[model samples]
Target: MKVTIDQDKCCAAGTCVLVAPDVFDQRDDDGIVILLNERPPAELHAAVREAADVCPGAAISVSEDA
Candidate 1:
């Protein structure tokens, strides 16, 4: 699974980071979403997806590569 974040759309709610800290983070200054892992392992895919789902701004995007 691949993860991407739209910083422009991110509300910096920190939900993504809370859901998947290993895959997401926030900028200290503006509190924008940061992409820690563009390509996370399969084991982390579920968390990454959950993070995307709970994102208040819907800033998180995910793509699955076969």
Candidate 2:
């Protein structure tokens, strides 16, 4: 799976980070969503999807690899 985040749309809720710290993170200064892994390993796909689903700001985007 591929992950992407829109900083402009982020509300700094930190849900993504909590759900998938390996795939997402927060900037210490403002707690904005940060994309830690653009293309995470297969083992992390589930968490990445969960993060995208629960993102309050809808800042997380995921694309599955064919």
Candidate 3:
């Protein structure tokens, strides 16, 4: 799976980080969503999806590899 985040839409909720720290993070200064892994491993797909689903700002986007 592929992951992307929109900094402008981010609310700094940190939910993505909580759900998938390996795939996402936050800037220490403002807590904006950070994309740690643009294309995470297959094992991390589930958590990445959860993070995307729960993002309050709808900043997370995921695309499955074809």
Candidate 4:
């Protein structure tokens, strides 16, 4: 899977960080999401998907690799 975050739409809710720290983080200054691993390992896929779905700002985007 591939992941991306739109900082402009981000609300800094930190849900993504909470759900999958390995795949996402927050900016120190503004608390915006900082994507750490654009392509997370298979074991972490569920958590990554959850992070995207539960993001309050809807800034997380997950796309399957074709």
Candidate 4, residue 45: the lDDT equals 94
Residues 21-49 of candidate 4 have per-residue lDDT tens digits of 99999999999999998988999999999
Residues 1-66 of candidate 1: C-alpha lDDT, one tens digit per residue: 778889999998998888899999999999999999899988999999999999999999999975
Where does candidate 4 clash, by residue pair? Answer: none
Which pairs clash in the backbone of model 2? Answer: none
Taken over the whole model, the C-alpha lDDT of each candidate is 0.91, 0.89, 0.91, 0.93
TM-scores across all candidates?
0.95, 0.94, 0.95, 0.95
Q: What is the lDDT of residue 52 in candidate 3?
A: 91
Local error of candidate 4 at 45, Å?
0.5
Off by over 4 Å in 1: none
**What's the distance in Å from true for residue 54, model 3?**
0.4
Off by over 4 Å in 2: none
**CA RMSD per model (angstroms):** 0.7, 0.9, 0.8, 0.8
Clashes of 2: 0
Candidate 3 lDDT over residue span 1-66, tens digit each:
778889999999998889899988889999998898899998999999999999999999999974
The better candidate by lDDT, 2 or 3, is 3
